[model samples]
Target chain A: METAFTPFTSFGGGLAIGLGAVLLMLGLGRIFGATGIMSGAVFITSRAELSWRLALIAGMVLAPVTLFFVTGQMPVLNVPVSPTMIVIGGVIVGLGASLGSGCTSGHGVCGLSRLSVRSLVAVPTFMVTAAITVFIIRHVFGA
Target chain B: MKLFYALITGLVFGIGISLSGMMDPAKVLNFFDLAGTWDPSLAFVMGGALIVTFVGYRLVWRRDAPLFEARFRIPTGTAIDRNLVGGSALFGIGWGIAGFCPGAAIPALGTGRWEVALFLLAVTAGFYLRRLLAPMQTARAAS
Candidate 1:
């Protein structure tokens, strides 16, 4: 399948994420880690922690409603993989992100932004492995 | 007030992912498929966000404390041990297989897909199971 090269839109989107992450740091002195936010939303018992996480999740879920108002259409998403593959992948991601203590937003964006040595190691290792996995699936197995 | 900031932050992030088209698993997968259909949009997204986040973080850190919080609650761990590398490798494999990072999936929940819901549920299960196994891994590390 041919992919669209969306330089402008992607860059614009990056700016928005940067702004969002910066806002979190400036206002709450927190790193905007999505997985952490998600898991905490489910597991953390602190009243304050839960409140903010729920609020953030609500915003995320409601964002498309806002998009509908402005763009007159909701953003469409495509899941190319089968449901079983999606479930298996999701389970693996959970184990991995939990063990690693972060995911893309955490390590890739927040940690790398801070220039943390640990994250510096993390970013490349994951990238190469991701590339290799794709190679295996696409070229080797020919999926 | 803190909750409000978090809500806005999430909204911004949701908007970013939507506009960047990261919510579309096929688009993300195409980025990994270098030989078949290479999309450089993801690179631009990362590069653009990095520029802003790198500079923005520097500025944010100049303050003694955040606007609402007394101190930053960032991670303190610096270890680059087995868990770090191994966990990241697993996460990368999962990402390559499905093209859905937690960062993208959380926001995509707005799209109301059954696949997203099921994947998220599986992830939650994986997280708890990993947490349960944490002590064993730590004991192994110590021994």
Candidate 2:
């Protein structure tokens, strides 16, 4: 797959993400953890709140879609792995996020900003583990 | 007023990160191409993030509590115990291999990447696994 980078585009994406985190934190009195949002949708009881959650999730899922359609510049996939491996990876990440009580957004962005210790630990843990795993896959196993 | 400001701040953060392109998977993947053609774009992203965070923290630190909340909610513990280390290791491995953390993964799905779907599933599984194993791990440690 071909890949390139542009400063303006990168800046736009970051701005949206940061703004989303801030908005979620301020309005709902909650952290914008992806896993948490999924969990809330799965478990919450109220219909009104459920709609808002659904809307939030929808926004996240659609934002890139809109970008792709409008720009005709589909985001390239950098991963080189089988569907099965990808699925396996997803399951593992899901479990980890739940165990950690938040995903990157909740902890990495909101939690870290709030200076939550759990997030501080979790963010670096996420970063380091991911780095080592990449090393092994790309170098050691040659996968 | 505090809550209002918090909401506005949240929006700014969310929009800001998105605009910065930090949410884009391909852009982030460029950071990992170190051995071949390493993309230095992420360094810029990090630089921007650090500056934002540094300034943001400095300003926020003055207040006893966050604008919308009762307390700042900073973590009290400073221990780098087993839980922190182990959890981080797992997270790093996943991210290194996949090149997508939870924050970026969700937006990636908007681009119709099957791999993003797979990674998200793994993340979910990891969360549950941690929950299931936590008690046992704790019990074993006690003994």
What is the TM-score of candidate 2? 0.72
Candidate 1 chain B: 10-residue stretch with minimal lDDT = B43-52
Please give, as one word, the docking class of candidate 2: acceptable
Per-residue alpha-carbon lDDT of model 1 for B30-140, expressed as tens digits?
888887778878887777777888898889989999988899888888899877888888888888887888888878888887877877887887799788998998898
A1-143: candidate 1 lDDT, tens digit per residue:
67679999999988887787888888889898888998998788799889988888877777777787889977767777888888888888888888777888899989999887778887787787778888898899988
- Across residues B22-98, which tens digit of lDDT does each residue of candidate 2 receive? 55545554456455434556555544544445455555566565444565433355566666556555555555555
Model 1: which docking level applies?
A: medium
* Overall lDDT per candidate, in order of appearance: 0.83, 0.59
